[model samples]
Structures are given as C-alpha cells and as structure tokens.
Target chain A: MATKRKQRMIFVIVLISGFAAATALALFAFQKNLLYFYSPSQLSEAEVTEDQLFRLGGLVVEGSVVRMPDGITTQFSLTDMQGQVQVEYTGLLPDLFREGQGIVAQGKLNASGLFVAQEVLAKHDENYMPPEVAEALKAAGGEHPVSIPKTTVE
Target chain B: MFTFLHKYASPQYFYSWSASWQKWASIIAALLMSVGLYYSLLNSPADYQQGETVRIMYVHVPAAWLSMFGYMVMASAAIVTLIWRIKVAEIMIAQCAVIGASFTALALITGMLWGKPMWGAYWVWDARLTSELVLLFLYFGVIALSGAFDDERAGARAAAILTLVGIVNIPIIHYSVEWWNTLHQGPTVSKFDSPSAHPSMLIPLLVMALAFKAYFFAVLFKRARTELLLRERNTSWVKALLKEAV
Candidate 1:
C-alpha cells in the first residue's frame, strides 16, 4: 500500500510540473506581442529606435488636433498631463474620436521625433476615458488624477 | 486525520451533512445576491470613465472569479480521487465541471459585452480572452470524458487525470491581463493596498463575490446529492434511501 501510494504521488507531481513547464514556455515565447502599448511618458523613457514600430497611448489634449487642409493627415498632441508627445495620423479616425478623449495610436516615431501613427483607436463615450489612459496619467504625474474617481457612490 | 476523512467517505454521512447545510447556504446566497444586485444595478456609482457600463463589473468580476474557483475545486477533487481512491471526490468533480462551465460561459459573455464599449471592439484574440475560452473547453472536456466509458470507474479515472493536467490553465487565466498587453484592463480591486473601486462600488462587488461563492456551494451540494444517488445506485445505502422514499 505504501509503495502504491508513493508511485501515485510521484505521478501526480510529474503531471503537474510538466504542464506548468509547458505554460511557462508558451508565455515566455509570446512575451513580446502580449505586451500592451506604451504611453507617451513611457516612450520617452525607453530607447526605442525612430523606425521601430510600437503602440503609444494617452489623452488627446484639447484644441491640439490639426487637420491638414488636404483632409487626410491629422495631427494631435497626446499627453498624460505631465509629459506629452505629438502624434500624426493620416486616416479617418474612429467615430468616437474627439478632443480630451483617450486613444491608442500604433506606428513609429519619425526622424524629427514626432509620432507618425499608422492606426488610431478611440470609441469611448463623452464621460469615459480608457482605463489604460488613466493608469498612464497616474504613473506620469505620480498622482492619481481626479478625472477618474475611485468611485462615485458616497 | 485519515480516519476522520475516511468517516465522511461513507456517503451517508456526507449526504446527511450536505442536506442540512444546503438550505442555510441557499438562504445566504439568495439574501446576498439580492442585496448585491440591488446595489450593483441601482446604487453603485458609475465608473468615472466607463460610466454606466462599468456596472457590468458587478456581475463580470464575480462570474470570472467563480469560473477559476470552480476549476480549482474540480481539480482539487481530481487530485483527491487519484491519491486516496475517494468516491465522493469523483462525484464532486463531476458536479464541479458543470458548475464551473456555467460560470466560464457567463464570464466570457459578460466580458465581451463590457469590452465592446470600452475597447471599441467586442472581441480581441488576446491573452486574457483566449485563455478564458480555453478554460471553457477544458471544462467541456472533463464533462465529456467522465461519461465516455462503458465502465464507470474507468471513465471517472480518465476524467480525473485529464483534470489534473488541465489545471495549469487557471493561473494563466488569472494573470493574463498583467502578463500581456491584452485589451482587457488590469486588476483594480484586488492588487492595490486598498481596492481601486470606491466604497459604494467596492462594497457591492464584494457582496456579489460572496453571493456567488455561497451559491456555488449550495448548488454543488444539490448536484452532488443527485450524483451520489446515480453512481451508488447498486449500493445498499442508496437502495435503502430509495426504499425509504417509496
């Protein structure tokens, strides 16, 4: 009985450890793509090459959007309130895109250090800011912004 | 300790104890669920950003947590059955698979609804969502495998082994948001020194979580009772139980 129990115990350990190893390996291999986009502040801190593609996120500061008269290119200043980056995109933005809204832009930095956006995502209601944008703002300003209150219920 | 555990293995003891506990658990579950739902739907403050849609968190978080918790319960039962040759644990695993699967489905559906407004898309094949879908499949596999064989014990044994192997998915489901750049948001209430959600929202979310837990066990006991009846049909105790009912 003792030997039988020992053998079963060994089998259980091998079974669990083997699965854990597989999960660890898969997560390790896919680590790069699983990462979320960087914020303007994070982009500034990192040593990303000008041509390297990545994600940048934050709020579109009010009145910062400029549409080239040609009507294709739009420029906007993205900020976490403490630090800011200029983003340039040449495409029709999501319908919900507006000033003071949170957004995530994907593309590369140009030689002039301006963000040349490939695609932009924004579909938030007037009152809502993306949680990611709020988090980045908190990190950049070193204080949780009152814009996203912890709760409204008294 | 061994004898104490083995004592409950008699099936009769477990059945009687579970029957008594089931009523109380159901009452607590009902009371808490009603109160939680009231606060969740009517009173809890809307998120500063997500607004009314943030209300989904009340159901979404609890359902998500229960899915993982149910899997753990099933996996632990799988381990107990293998190690000690416990019959009740096998029955418990079968019941847990059903309950866990329900919660996983709820989690997935509610998550998609919540994501649509916040992320500008209903679905993303990201780490968090994919792993949760996989967790659902694992539940399906266990339920199917446990009933696959003509020989009952052999079927149970196979299902138990599968569960032990698939248990690795639980942690992956939990940490997915943190580990990857998924569209899904990160932990708000759980990781911080204090919950990130405010007092009004946080309180109800917690109440809902507890309500789900109590509800899981209440339903678990009922299913386990039925399982014990079917699986032990030939035993003298079950025969007596049926005869007494008749």
Candidate 2:
C-alpha cells in the first residue's frame, strides 16, 4: 500500500511537471518567432525581423494615399498623429476603407522599414470596433470613436 | 432503486463496476472518434476564406467544447461527492480532473497552432483566447488543490470548493468574446439565429463534439476504476474481482 501510494504521488508529479516542462521548452524555442502587434510608431523604432508578420495600425494619413502605376499595388502613409510610416499593399482594400480612418495592416517590415501588407482591414465604425484597435488608437491619440459624434467621427 | 444507487456509493462496489464499464466505453469511444475524424478531415469542404486551414477547426472546436464540458463533469462530480459523501463520486472527480486538464491543454495548443496560420499570431489577448487560458488555469488549480492537503478527504473537500468557485468563470469566458469588443470571432455553432456555419462544417463539428464526449467518458471510466481499485484494494469485493480476473 505504501509503495502504491508513492507511485500515485509520482504519477501526479510526473504528469504536471512533464506538461509544464514541455510547454516551457516549446515557448522558449519559439520565443523569437512569436509575432507581436505594434502600432506604426512602435514599429518605427523597434528592431523587427524582416520575416516576422505583425499587425500595424494607425490613421490613414490624409491625402497621402498614392497608387503605383501597376494598378494592383498602392502606397499610403500611416500616422499615429505623432509619427508616420509608409505602408504598401497589393491586395484589394476592404469596404469602409477611407482616408483618415483607422486601419490594421498585417505584414512584415521590409529592409527599408516599409510595411509590406499582406492583409489590410479597416476598423469598422464606432459600434463595432475591436477593443485592441480602440486601445491602440486611444494610446496613439484620443481617437476614441465611441466618444465622438457619429456624424462627425465617420 | 435506492438500494442499487447506494450500493455503488461504496469504493468496493465502484471499483468492480468501473472495471466492467471501462472496456465497453473504450470501444464505443474509439468507434465514434474514428467516424468523426474521418468525416471531419476528408468529407468537409475547405473554408471559403481560410482554405485548408479550416480543417483545423474540426479538432480545435471539439477540443475547446470538450474542455468546458469536461470541467462541468468534474465540477458536478465534486458537488455530488461533497453533498452525498459518495466515495464513487470522489473517485470520478479525481479521474475527471486529469482527463479534463489534458483536454484543456490540447485545446489551447491546437488553438495556437491554428491561430498561427489564420490569425498570424500564435497567442493573443483577445477575450476568447484569454478566457480559455483562464479555464486551463482553473483546471490546474483544481488538480493542484486536490493534492495539497496531507489528508485525502481534506484535499477533496478543498478541491470541491475551488471547483464550485471556478464554475462562475465559465460563463464569463463564453461571453467574453461577445461582451467586449474582441478580435476573436463570435459563435458559429452555439447561436440562436440560423447558424452561420455551412452544412458540411456543421455536420463534422457535431460529430467531433459527440466523439470527444464519448472519449471523455471512456477515459474517465477507466481512470475512475483505477482510482477505486487503489483506494479499496483491501476490500472483499476488490479481492474477489481480482481473483476472478486471474
């Protein structure tokens, strides 16, 4: 009975410890590969790898929208209302996308520090905006869409 | 009926019953999972937006659903053990904890793997993801608390209290994605409206859910039986059952 009890304790310990160790090892091995989202300003100063796809968000800087001659590719500048970074996308823009509105572009940094967007999403207007977008916008500037007048905000 | 129910409350009776049930449950579970996995992986259509990556949903959704379902089972057993002083319930509760924790870990890991290709991030603080992580922690807490006390009964009672407390978090987790503006998509299956899910998607999801539930019952039955035998090794019924098997 005593030996059986000892075995039980060892079994429980091994299960928990084994899982914990495996998870820790996996996380450590992939630590650098873990993708983190960044605002346009953070990406500017952050040392981001060229291959790491990350989220970059900001207001589409007014009148900075310029499409290249290829017709498929477009270049625009994103600003946190403090700093600006150029972003390029070759895909079709999402509906509700417009200048001066919030957008999150998913892609990685190029060697020149330009954001090469694989996917571009426009933050839907006030009532449906995601919290992360709202917080990011808020931190960048007081761009709280919910608090703004519906007519004026849009 | 009362006497029959009462008989199984003893560790000795439970040990014998669990051994018999384990084999039957295992066979049923294996059969269900085989059908479910095959249909999910091969017959289902690739998602319109996600392409082949949507196939991961078959495993991810079922695992997530089972993790929650398993916790509920464990919590219910804990309540019964506490209220009725049933040794069988205690054994079931302990066994279910191990299995539930395993399912929760599987769900979290599978979700991360799916997220990498779909969401571009393996982990996110979105409401759904965070709440699921919390659920995993809750399972770990129950398992830890159960073993914390030197006296087994004391440990069980303490763990039971923790389980009851953790039940409150489940609903919060379910609605967290909806309540707060979250990046995670809302429910496709558990909805009041005509489900946004296609027939192909829905069929595989349901099959997988049933398969996972069966698997849980099978494993829990086996583990509970082992627990009962360990606790009641000196009892006459266990001895008789052992002799017969030999």
Candidate 3:
C-alpha cells in the first residue's frame, strides 16, 4: 500500500531517535554526576559555599607540572590564559595528564587559592577539545592552537 | 533469469565480464593489503607520544571507518533496489550486510583491546562506544531479516527497508566522541582541514583503508557473481555456459 512508504519513514525516525534517547538516558544514569564542569575563571567568580564540590576546567601550565617524590601528592597551576588558578591534589594523575593539555578537575578552592581537587580528567589526544575550553584558550590569546594538517586531506 | 528488462545486454555478457573483473580485483586487493600490513606492522615508527600502542590506530580507525562507509553503501543500494527493483542492488545488500557487520565487530573488539591499556578501562557505557554497538546489532538485524522469509524476494525487500532505516547510526557513531563526554578519542585523519596524526602515521592508515576498500570490492564481486549465476540458473545462456564448461 502507499502507506508503506510513510510507514518506512516513520520507522526510520523512530529507530534513530530511540537509540539516541536510550544512550542519553544511560549516560545520564551511569554518570549521575555528569561532571563535565566549569573552568577556573567561572569558579573564581562564583560565590561558592564551603565544601560545595564542583568542577574546575583549564590547561595545566608548562613548567608547572611537578610530581612529588612521594608520588602521592602534586600541585599545578591551571590557566585559562586570561586568568590562572593553583590546584593542589594528592592522587595519581591520569596517564594523559601533562602540561598544556585541557582538563577538568572536581573539587573546591580554599581561601589560600589552592584547588583541593578530588579528581582530574585529562582530554585524549584525538584532537578533540571541549568547546568551552577552546573558547577560553582562544580568549587567552591561544597557545599552540590546533592547526589542521597540510596533506592527505581527507 | 535476470531478465528484468535485460539491463546487462545479456546474462552471459555479465557473467564473463564479472568473472574477469573479479580476478583482477582479487589480485589488486591482495597486493594492496600485503603492502598495507607491512607498513602498519613493521615499517612505520612507533608514535613517540603514545608509544607502540599508537599502532592500534591503523586498524581500529580504518575498520571503524569502513563499518560506517559500508552501511552507507548498503543503504544507497537499498534505495536503488526499491525503486528500480534491481536484483544486483539487492544482492549488494546481502554482500554489504555481512562485510559491514564483520568490520563493525572488528572495530569494537580492537577498540576494547586498545582501550584497556590507554583509557584505563576495558569498556565504558559512553556515547561513542554505545552507538557503535548499536550499529553492529543493526547489521545483524538486517542479515537476519533479509533471509527470514521462504520467498527470497520478500526477504530482500524487508532487509532493504531495515537497512535504509538504520542509516541514521552512521553519523551518530562518527560524532559521538566529539559531541559528548565519552572516554573515546576524536577523529584524527577524517577532518578535511588538517589531520591530527603525523604524515608518517596517516599514510599507512590511508593505505590500509584503500586495501580494505579493494578487499571489499574483491569479495563483493565474488559474491555478486555467485548471486548472478543462481538468479540466472533457469536461463538458456546459463545452461549453455555450464554445458560448455562441462
């Protein structure tokens, strides 16, 4: 019947959206914290209460990454280029954690301007950067801004 | 007898032509794959940053890519078969279904192996991985639906509809890592402006992709020939050809 074509269209849309929503719900459920969070600049400006845990995003500044000899505690300066914040944490860093890469840390800032980070996530080198972080970097006059390569251009 | 308006001039012509093309395709695909494997495994230098594990990118990336590419091809053929009722396009759906499914599964398995060492987890229920898993299931669904009926034509029709409907997953898989907080890495060579990987790495990856394409064509022609033969089994030309061979 002519309704077959309409039926096909409906089927396709329903399937696509169904898969999308299913994952969306699953991600929400699994990541109840869903902690892809705010940058250092945003955190500094916010009127946060004591022990109010939240995310802090920015890049780890060069020459600022130092591992403690104990290997359990470390400190680094996170920069948005325009402003910077010092973060102090006691834990193992992510393997991809290094200087000059984008990251989001979860914790609260002490009055001493130190971020007592509970968790730090480093972005993968698949050339993907969060849009918010990229914008912050751009506003900071950009350091090593990602340039698309010159050849085999597909 | 493949006599749907005689699109091939003659079924005999199609068989002979396809046979020759199939021979050449297999030869080229073999040569290309050997060279590609050589570069991927031995010749290429390890990524200075990611160390030797970066080599996984060669297979994992291309296989993931072809999985999506194969589905797109299948969906297009489905549309062609629906409107023109081309038997070859329907056969293509069958061929593409199996090839695409295998590649999708390969992408997933390799991804898991690569993830455990690098990402610190064997698997995460994130956007990129989950969507790709859905893609593999869709291919399986197509393969099952297409062969479900006692009537072959009816089966192909049902399979074709499902294949077209499943086309939405291709983009989802490609952009999942980029669009979400998934632990998956983003595209390296797929970007048109500039690729993230170095030329040394990109070249071998591209070569391997070409090899995969050539292999797809080689197998495709092989399967299509068998399909053509069976579809034309009742025709006079097929009988003549078989008699001559005997």
Candidate 4:
C-alpha cells in the first residue's frame, strides 16, 4: 500500500509540473503573435504600429471605393459608422463584393500605416453581413438590416 | 456548488452520479440534435454563393469546434486529476479523449468534402489544416500513452502528462492563421469586435454549436460513468450500484 501511494504521488507531481511547463512555453512563444481583433475606431485611438498583421472588419464604406490604375487593384475605406480604415487589395474578389456590404480583410499594415489586404471576403447577399460587422455596426449605433422573417433558408 | 462538487471527487460517488447524468444527458442530446439538424438542414437558408456546400458548415464547423473543445476538456480534466489527486478526474480525462478524437476525425472528413469543390483541392498544407492534423496526432499520442503501461494507474498518469504537454499546441492552432499566410479564412465567430458571419449563417452556427456541446456532455457522462465503474469495481458502493442496476 505504501509503495502504491508513493507511485501515485510521483505521478501527480510529474503531471502538474508538465502542465505548468507546457503552458509557460506556449505563452512565451505566442507572446507577440496573438493579435486581437480591432475596429477602425479602436485602431485610431490605440497605439498601432505600421507592421502588425491585424484584423480589420466592417462594412465597405459607401461611395468610398476606387479602382487603381491597374483594373485588378482596388482601394476602399471600411467603416463601422464611428471610424474608417483605408484598405488596398489586388485580387479576384468574391462574387458578393460591393459597397455597403460586409467584408473581412486579412493582411498587414504598410509603411504608411495603411492596410494592405491579402484577401477580401464579402457577404453573399444583401441581407447577409458578417456577425463581426453587425456587432461593430450595432456598437456604432447602426441597426442590423436583416430580421428573421417567417421564411427560413431552406 | 464547490462543496457539492467536492463530494463527487471520490470515484465511487462520481460513478453513481455520472450514471444518472448519462441517462438524462443522452435523452437531451437526442432531442437537441434532432431539432438542430432538422432546422439547419431543412429550414436554414441555402447559401447564395456556395449552395449546398454551406450545409457542410453545419457539420464541419461544429465538429471542429467540438474537437478543440474536447481537447480543452480532456486536458483540463487531466490537470485537475494530477493537481487534486481526484480519481474521478482521471475517468473524465479518459472519457473525453475518445469523444474528442472522434470529433476531430469528423471535422477533417467533412472539411475535405467542403474543400474539394470550394478550394479546388481535397487537401492542402494550409495553416488551419496543418494545425488540425497536429491536433489529431496529439489526441492519438494521449490515447496511445494511456495503454502503454501494464499498470492502469501508471498509464493514466503518463497519459495525463502527455495530454498536458500536447495542450501547448492548442494556442498555436488557434493563432496559426494570424501567424502564417494561410489559404484558410480567419476566425468568423470567436473574436471580440465583430463576427464575420451573417445573421442567416450565424444563428444556425450558434445553434449547432450549442447542440454539439450538449451531445458532448451526454456522451462524456456515459463514458465517464462507465470508466468510474470499471476503476472502482472492487469498492462496496460499486457492488451495491451494480446490483441496483441489474
């Protein structure tokens, strides 16, 4: 019985120590890379550097979109009704791309602190908007466009 | 609640409690899943873009969520078992491993079905995919470690250690999209600012997520109760419990 208890104690100690070590190691490695999601309003207020690859999500600002010299490249501003972010993207866009639509841009900040989007994903329908966009809009005092009607999506 | 939980730390007491919970949870799980699937498949709006592929999201996304969730549950149980020396915690760790691994496998398979048409490839070394694959291996390693030793107690302890070590990969998996230039899309629901999912898509996703959680609780209760019974078979309470069941 004494030997059995000794074994159990040793096992408990090893397992606890192992968890502590792993958690410490993980936190140390990811200290810099875990970027929190931010709105344009928050980004403007906060101390954001030009090199961070952070996420900026909201509706494509109406009438603020412009095509660059290259037809494939487009520049637009995204807004949450409170603040706005200038974004540049050069790629084939999703079919739903349009002004007043929701979009999530993934990329890094440029030397000028402007967002250089690697990808731009647009909402599929007039009624559809990303939840993040809706939340930001709600926070910015805008009402959500779509209500659950009697009809379901089948 | 703390005092209530404290009593069930003993394997013998936990076995009886879990047995009762298993029956209730299983029934609830069946009910919730039936409603969730019926509503999601037949009533939810078809995607204007992806069409039927969006349906795959109902299964794939929730399975992925549960996969990560399962690992978290297992690892947390492992931590509790080791720190508190609670036998019931070990049972929970073991039970969660089986269930979590199954969810991970489902997520991968459903993802493949969705990816073949959407991404134009069945498999790619994207950050999200790779991290998910690594998670599968971690599950396997934990499962394998549990059976390695002749002594069940020693095996459980070793597996608990492995589960703890493997949890380091969870953060890496979650942040892989941000850290690397991956083809996979970033998070849609689990952020602070805005979720990138539309209300039509978002409501179903949330409902499905809840359904999956319920299913997990149902299954884990069953497995944990069985494990407790097995581990404490020699105890007097277990014999009485078995007699009652029979």
Alpha-carbon TM-score of each model against the true structure: 0.82, 0.65, 0.72, 0.65
- Which sections of candidate 1 miss by over 4 Å? A36-63, A67-74, A77-102, A106-119, A122-154
Using DockQ as the measure, the top candidate is 1
Q: DockQ, per-model, please?
A: 0.26, 0.04, 0.16, 0.08
Clashing pairs in 4: A131-B195, A131-B197, A132-B194, A132-B195, A153-B44, A153-B45
Residue B113, candidate 2: how far off, in angstroms? 1.2
What docking grade does candidate 1 earn?
Answer: acceptable
Writing each residue's lDDT as its tens digit, candidate 1 over B158-226 gives 888999899888888888766654556657677557555666777898999999999999999999988
Per-residue lDDT of candidate 2, residues B1-246 (tens digit): 646777876676666667667777778778878888888788766754456767777898888888888888987777665655567776666677788788888988987876665545577665577768888888888888888888777788778767766676677567654444344555667764666566667877788888788788888887777777777788888789889999
| Error in Å for residue B190 of model 2 | 1.1
Q: How would you class the docking of model 3?
A: incorrect
Q: Supply the DockQ value of model 2.
A: 0.04
Q: What share of the true interface contacts does each candidate keep?
A: 0.35, 0.00, 0.16, 0.08
Q: How close is candidate 1 to the true structure, as a TM-score?
A: 0.82
Q: lDDT of model 1 at residue A139?
A: 76
How good is the docking of model 2, by CAPRI class?
A: incorrect
Look at candidate 4 and tell me the lDDT of residue B103.
94
Give the whole-model CA lDDT for all candidates, comma-separated: 0.79, 0.69, 0.73, 0.72
lDDT of 3 by residue, A6-77 (tens): 666566656657866776676557542332455555555556776788766677888997777887888998
Better of 2 and 3 by DockQ: 3
C-alpha positional error of residue A30 in candidate 2 after TM-score superposition, expressed in Å: 32
lDDT of 2 by residue, A1-154 (tens): 5565466546544544565566557645643333223556556565778888777766788798998999989899887766678999997886445677666688987888788999876542212222454466679987445211011110
Name the 10 consecutive residues with the lowest summed lDDT in model 2 chain B: B176-185
